[model samples]
Target: MQDWWNAFMPYPDVDVGHASTGPLSGLRLAVKDLFDVAGYPTSAGNAAVLAASGIKTATAPLVQALLDAGAFFAGKTNTDELAYSLIGGNVHFGMPRNPRDPDLIPGGSSSGSAVAVAAGLADLGLGTDTSGSIRLPAAINGLIGWRPTHGSLDNRALRPLAPSFDVPGFMTSSLEPMAAVMSAVGMPATNDRPISILIPEDIFETIDGVIADEMIASLRSSAMPIRKINSIASFSLADLAVAFTTILQKEAWESNKTLFEQSPDAIAPDIAARLRAGSRLDDEAMREADRIAALFSREVNRLLCENMVVALPTLAMNPPRRYAGPDSFAAFRSACIKLLCLSGLSGCPQLAFPIVSRAGNVSLSLVGARSADRMLVNVARRLSTCLKEQMPF
Candidate 1:
């Protein structure tokens, strides 16, 4: 089907069957291009990869589980090249239309998946989150997005970007469907009612002044008690971003190097530059970046252990316009990465729930500790008067 939004990858009648009875009964599921599904090509959003692939022999175990749980396959959605950038436009397959605003970019890697759900083409969107793929788009498009704690869900049969950071995640238009998916996957529920909300002073400081003021004001209006504290050991956002990019470059290059090696011309110019950046990093730099990342993970996880959820703007700014200039996009990405790297490095469960204001469509993300995925979902459900009204769920 040629969707108006270009959310799905073109395929020849890619069919999926599901159980008659299960928690996910009759739910429409949109699969990201990265996952292997029987009877369809697994392109991973790169034309070279698409050209090299054939119909997969076996469905990914994760997709199988969802199918068994009774979710019907909607279609495979578009993604960024090899699932790399945060903003959506793919060089080969055109960018997925953002249901929120046509001109605004749907957040990337998981862009098409998010668009699928937001545009009412699917009940749930299956995507992966290494950095902000799921959460970022969910925020921009006003959908509920969950990046499960790393390793809490199956990652097998999905294309690897950074193995240590890659995790299977999903997007949905609302809460009940998300809860059903969680139940189908057997994610245990948590009683961790958030006792406090941690507002990292440094994160807000990095945002543009108007957006910062609006976010803080919005949070203050919430019923949950908020605590402002200095964090990251005096490390600037650039430091944390550097830590994430350095490690991702190394791991991503290693995971997909063979593809690049075989089809040297397949890599997009931007993606190639990122891969080269990683390729040139010396072994020692990778190790040092890893060390810093581990420390940050521990620090963030420690806060979560106390039943405190970290709350911040999901993306540092509103989504950039489509086909933005490279220099401008690069600068924009650098700022956004700092906010995204928090959950990426920690491997914690971060959920983005939309909260639209007169200013624009913005979102507040609540991050829980590892394995606290269900808790954040529950927290979203318990949103106070103001937040509840803004929630699509």
Candidate 2:
């Protein structure tokens, strides 16, 4: 599987057995390289980081929980260097191919996890989402990607991107496996009643016209009552994006400063440049970013309370072409950050699911109130079933 997809880091295959009986008994899972696997060094997608990291003495509790529940481990998948980029093209390890369309970029830094699941190499794949890493890949590759509310899941053994925004997430082809995995980790059960849906007019308008129309049509066909809101709060999407980028860069720089300073050349040039830029951010800018983020979080929470959900496009546009030059790719990423920043800023749970459109596959996303992880999954399940029956597009 690794040979075909380039989805895994270069390491000997390691498989751990599951118990004879449990909910996930026969499932095969692939973990991102960032998680601590007992006796294996966590590479975090960089050769130097791998070399500097000593073997882990214990496994991440999340990984242990899955193993204890009867799921078998399928080795580590590749990640963006330091999990910094959403493009998923790692300079150190080669890009993981998008199984659905080989020429397109697989969304990342969770790139490999999405590929593993989409290609049927693994039943489930673990990845971290910090600023849309999980959801973006899930959207581009036509899979279910989930980001639990901030602090809902423990992050002790996972690699840090921006600790404030990073959360452990997974990618699967369908909702059932995702629900089973969440149950094993003790996530709360979802409410099964009908939910109130809110469409953020500004955010939806950011998407390409063709994709937006397809997404709207799908929502309408669900026969669920939907309301359009001019804004989630006083903040615009651009404002949220700026605030997220400012704080994320500041924290990311702090998290990886030592590595960047010690072995600058060991990191990929594009990622290294971004880190260097982060290091230059001043205290005043970060303080303002924090202030804006706090206000945004409060407003978003208010809007999503009481079984309410927000729907929007996962990516403003489709995935960029493979090897799109750094300049073009950078622009595309900036545009996407405008939409992705909403989830990060508000500390809410978001689920990205695929919608078949004339342009191929595009993604539709649902954002739920903070700590409403299970509800978002429930919504995705219902929406997925409806789409299949209606085939609205």
Candidate 3:
């Protein structure tokens, strides 16, 4: 019963000396290890990286924003090695146990961030979602995780994985706190337009039956009208994965080449393998990946039009069982990333809120327009309010 991810730093005293105190003052907040918090070493779940890269001397912009917003920080949480894997397991820091069911694996690379929130250890937790890092864990843990549009938040001090898609996100048990954190972190929080929830026929079909039903029922009860829309004409998920990998690899290779070349033996095995994989992607393939990304972005925008938020299951499958076999891992990872990329491609905002439980598992997901993050927040808030009212004893 020992908490492997327990906070080394106790909750901060917000009222004594901090901005925006008394409101979010005592609220507990946890940051992913990738973010630089002034005096802390950004371990990024790797001992080698911590030793190799010098200690961060200043707080990251996002960290500063959270602190300024009156959040009582609970210290850094665990992450996947170099924030690369969707699964949270690390050879170094043991896997963070899922709060809902200890028998299952907590989704990652934003592993501990979501668990911290789900376990009620923190009011809000910060995580980075490049693929399904934030949303997948949020889905599994039954929490609300919001990944804003690309470039919506500053990435000045965050360690990069896939720079193009590595947007910082937040996890909380409810949409109110998630929206509050986003607003505090500088995302617009309110909108005046009537909300439109778009259900993508192709992507929704991929979700497990029970989870999808819960999500759909929640949407139906909302004050807004739900529309059936198809964005991004049918495309191979495998192709998207190849493109995402090529781009991440090319960027990672360029970013870590010096350190990797200098002390190739010092890096973690998983991270090393990932970097090596990136190195293997051909230049032509990388270019093709970029082309596909651009093509998809345009198509997605056209499909969304305006004032319409796309909705889909946060994860295509259920939480992975702890120590799942290699084949299970592959299948779980594939489903998780495939659904997430729909939003990642267009750089749209996504707000994953857990609606209900089925067979002892939580059902969850997000809906939002590209760059229209404020509208999405408003929509989520309204949806959560409606669901609470409709709940029967």
> Which lDDT value does model 2 have at 289?
93
Per-residue alpha-carbon lDDT of model 1 for 1-393, expressed as tens digits? Answer: 448999999887755788888888879999999999988989999988888888888899999999999889998999999999888888799889888898888888899999999999999999999878898888888998899988988877898999978988989988889888988897887885547777888888877778777777767766778788886444667888898989888999998889878886888889988887878899899888889888888777666788888888888866678777887677767778888888888888898887666677677788887877887877777663566565454
Local accuracy by lDDT, each model: 0.84, 0.86, 0.75
**Which pairs clash in model 2?**
none
> What are the runs in model 2 whose C-alpha is more than 4 Å off?
15-17
Which candidate has the highest TM-score of all? 2
In the range 1-393, model 3's lDDT, one tens digit per residue, is 234554222223222224667446667878898888866778777777777657567888887877777887677888877777787787777688887878888888899888888887888889998887888888888888888888889898888877888899888887667667766777765558675677776677777676666677767877678877554445676677667767877787767777678878767676788798887888789889999988877877776666767777777777679888757877888777777776676688888876644444454455565667767667766776787787663
| TM-score pick, better of 2 and 3 | 2
Q: What are the models' TM-scores?
A: 0.95, 0.97, 0.90
Between prediction 2 and prediction 3, which has the larger lDDT?
2
Q: In candidate 2, residue 194 scores what lDDT?
A: 76
lDDT-superior candidate, 1 or 2:
2
**Full-model lDDT, candidate 3:** 0.75
Ranking by TM-score: 2, 1, 3
Candidate maximizing lDDT: 2
Off by over 4 Å in 1: 192-194, 232-234, 384-393
Q: Sorted by lDDT, highest first, which candidate order results? A: 2, 1, 3
